[model samples]
Target: MAEVSNKQVIFKDYISGFPTDADMYITTSTISLKVPEGSKAVLVKNLYLSCDPYMRPRMTYTTDSYVDSFKPGSVIEGYGVAKVLDSGHPNFSKGDLVWGFTSWEEYSLITSTEMLIKIPTTDVPLSYYTGILGMPGLTAYAGFYEICTPKKGEYVYVSAASGAVGQLVGQFAKLLGCYVVGSAGSKEKVDLLKNKFGFDEAFNYKEETDLVACLKRYFPEGIDIYFDNVGGKMLDAVLLNMRVHGRIAACGMISQYNLDKLEGVCNLINIIIKQVRMQGFVITSYYHLYPKYLEMVLPHIKEGKIVYVEDTVEGLESAPQALIGLFSGRNVGKQVVVVARE
Candidate 1:
């Protein structure tokens, strides 16, 4: 087989603060389409790439973190949807559609088939795998239903509620007959939380100088469940506003990811005062429940009971900017990059 040009997004170095488009560079390299003889690797044509906040932590130089840091001068890796062109694995074959951890490139030779999931249904858009039916979906499902243990008529609050996981968490709360409110960074997202995602109340956090007072106004009875995405001050405020026996599912701390010095939450004593339970989770811990998750969420998606919003950029060249846009709140929904069609 002839060598084909592969366009890739390469990590420049370990970042100290907020990442920029300059932190990653696009370069072209040649690769043979065929897998090596006797290898259990699969060659994939990447379709869509997901830009997630979790990827930010991996950019830093760290050996103690749960996930491995991205190597400098190497192709950046993230979750993506792809089509199998050739496979040496028994579980996958040519023309198979899958979603998994793939490099930010047009094509990739994926050796870690364990991480790859075969796409069973094609009725929905393939890009949905990068957001709704993918990691974000499972994260929201496990974090809310499993961790929060939601009940009907509970008062629920979700931070970063217009983003991928948060949006779903709000909707799920509503589905369970809970009174749900959400917080976002902008007016447009605030509107989305109320009008589109079906939150009972929504607020723009940037507009509120006093977060504690803001939470008081929204949840006068105090929050029974808090789906924490943006931690720090928001968390501190929620700690004060939480009802006795409240549950907090710590999904992501987006507010602290880019900070040079991580902010401390002083109101942690409130957890003990109220006898509240606060738990942090990693999505990979619940991968065994993916089948059950799909069984529940997929039907809701097909029946129009749940909806997903995505902010998509076209081509491999747009990958870096799309990723950097996450920290700045430039994208209103799930950030995705379309690498190829088919």
Candidate 2:
């Protein structure tokens, strides 16, 4: 087997507070093109790397969390779209396109095939696997439809509404005939929520002095469902404004990921008083529903019934900054790194 240079994003070390590009370094190492004999691993060429908020938590050293922390001096792991070049696994073969958990490298020997999904069709952009067709997509699908149990004409709110998961949740709410409102950090994102994603109303949370008053103004009748992504003060506010028996889908808390001391929800008592059903979910648990999700979302995508936006940068070298940008609200949409076009 011939060897090729593999460019990688290596995690430097566990750290406190916001992670910078310094946390990850780009390096090149040689790798063989074939999977070793008697090995059941799949050798893949990464096409697109997903920059997700959840990946932030994994950057720290923590056994307290269910997700394992990224090891120092190793290629950071993330969900990406890939092309199999060689395989010792029976389920996969050479030239098979896949999307799932993979390392932040140009080439990877994927030993675990349990989470990997063969890309069903190439008609959609392969990068969709990194966003709309991958983890974030499933997160939104499971969180909104399954967790929130939204009904027609319900009042819905989504924080970080222009983000990968949040954008989809708001649109899904609208599709169900719900009145959707979303909050974002910038006017550009807020405009995207209202004008692009079809949210009934959108606001820049940065401009709001009081999130509780903000939600109350958006939903005078009180929120029926809250798709919370940036939890912190926003979540506390939503807790206070939730209607009786309302549902809350706790997706990702980008606001709390970098903090040493996690923020507490002060209006938790309102959960009991209002009888709100607030549930946090992990997307891995809902992978079984993926086939059903694809069936529903694909048509909506093709028909333009549902739209997705992505902020893409070229090459593996750009990945670290792209991932770091999520916390600062620097990317306009789903941040993706293009490793290989094919």
lDDT of 2: 0.94
Best by lDDT: 1
Clashing pairs in 2: none
In candidate 1, residue 176 scores what lDDT?
Answer: 95
lDDT of 2 by residue, 1-342 (tens): 779999999999998899998899999999998999999999999999999999889988889876899999999999999999999999999999999999999899999899899999888888999999999999999999999998999999999999999999999999999999999999899889989999999999999998889888999999999999999999999998999999998888999999999998888999999999989899889999999999999999999999999999999999999999999999999999999998
lDDT of each: 0.94, 0.94
* Stretches of model 2 off by over 4 angstroms after superposition: none
